[model samples]
Target: MQDLAIWYEGTALAGALRGSGHLYMVVNAAHILGIGLLLGAIIPLDLRLVGIIRSGPIGIVGPFLSRTAGVGLCIALLTGGSLLSVSASEYLRNDAFRWKMALLGLGMLTIAAQHGGGRWRRAVETGVPDPRTRFLAALSLMVWLSVLLSGRWIGFL
Candidate 1:
């Protein structure tokens, strides 16, 4: 893993990111935009699912929010990989980075399982959420928030 990280740290992409004026900063901004898009869409959706916000129908906005969150996730992953490649070895050794990764994986798995589960589909179709769906929604909110916190903790650690 260290060898791979070291190799990534020397890649042309990493070198270019380091050498270019303002490119790294632009990338960082884009990463923040992605995170903002994701949380902005997801938090409300999750809140709705968990009965925290009771104004709208689930089916009315669920699909759009989910898709927007997906796009944000993709952008974040791509930019984040580039950012990591700039100092892959150091990040690899960071305990906070490891925790962030683990939490991210769990959050993704929760997304998949919740979306694929019959309860979620039924809830979307019927415009009503079950206990399990609500629980998963709450879980996703916590896990993703933890991911964000852990990522922030990475630099400090």
Candidate 2:
């Protein structure tokens, strides 16, 4: 792992990012925008799924928000990879970074499980919240919030 990190640090992209202040700033800003998009989309959808906002129909809102959040996740991963390449060695050693990665993996799996479940499909088709769907929603909310927090912790730790 250390050797891999060393190779990453020696890569041209990493060198360029490390050498250029303006480029780094742009990448960082893009990363933040991606995160904002993700959180903005997911939180509202989660709220609806959890029955916090009962006015809007979940069937109508769920697909749209999920798609939007998917796009955000793609953007975040792209930018995050670039950022990580800029300081791979340090980040690989950071406990917060590790936690963030673990949470991200769990979050993705949770999403897959939620979408794969028959109950989720039933809820989507019937415009009703099943217990399983609600449970997944709550789990998603917690996982994503923890991911966000851990990502922030990477900087301080």
Against the unseen true structure, what C-alpha lDDT does each candidate score?
A: 0.91, 0.89
RMSD of 1: 1.0
Best by TM-score: 1
Per-residue lDDT of 1-157 in model 2, one digit per residue for the tens? Answer: 9899889889998988999999989988989888888888988888888898787777788888888888888889898999899889999999999999999999999889888958776777788878888898999999999999999999898
Best by lDDT: 1
Q: lDDT of candidate 1 vs native?
A: 0.91
Every candidate's CA RMSD: 1.0, 1.2
**Model 2: residue 131 alpha-carbon error in angstroms:** 1.0
> What is the per-residue lDDT of model 1 for residues 15-86, given as tens digits with 9 covering 90 to 100?
999898599999999999888888888899999999999988898888888889888898899999999989
User: Model 1: which ten-residue window has the lowest total lDDT?
Assistant: 117-126
